[model samples]
Target: MTRKYIDCREFPSEMNCTVAISADSEKELLEAAVQHAVTIHHHADSPELRAQLVTLFHEGTPPTEAPRTA
Candidate 1:
């Protein structure tokens, strides 16, 4: 697992963010991104965000959670 730090300082200027993870494939990247979001950004990342991150990092698929049927 080779980790990379993506410094998105050029685009989305407001976000002074850095993503560090070992993502060999597309799926890994998405998972890492979500983890980064929840743990660091504290953002309840939407599915759209997950998809975008997948495209950006070219890694893992984001895991889907089943809706709670109370």
Candidate 2:
């Protein structure tokens, strides 16, 4: 199966978090991303959150580091 990932730096947040999450499957990636969002970002877990995250899913593994931001 193709790997998938989600990068926090893609979204602008108060913390400017640099975390990048990846998994061998979409299900795994979603679960881990949800946990990170709820615990680290203090976001409420809900269907809406999950939907939004789905849109952010990226194919393949994340880069070794987050892209540089100005």
In candidate 2, clashing pairs total: 0
List model 1 lDDT by residue over 1-69, tens digit each. 544333233234245553345456556556766887777777687998787665555233222432222
lDDT of 2 by residue, 1-70 (tens): 8999999987778988989999999999999999999999999999999999989899998888666664
lDDT agreement with native, every candidate = 0.52, 0.91
**Model 2, residue 59: displacement in angstroms?**
0.5
Top-lDDT structure, candidate number: 2
Q: Considering only N, C-alpha and C atoms within 3 Å, which residue pairs clash in candidate 1? A: 25-59, 26-58, 26-59, 26-60, 27-59, 27-60, 27-61, 28-60, 29-60
After superposing candidate 2 on the true structure, give the runs of residues whose Cα lies further than 4 Å from its correct spot: 68-70
RMSD of 1: 12.7
TM-score of each: 0.50, 0.89
Cα error, residue 55 of model 2, in Å, equals 0.9
lDDT of 1 at 7: 29
How many clashes in each candidate?
9, 0
Model 2 per-residue lDDT at 65: 65
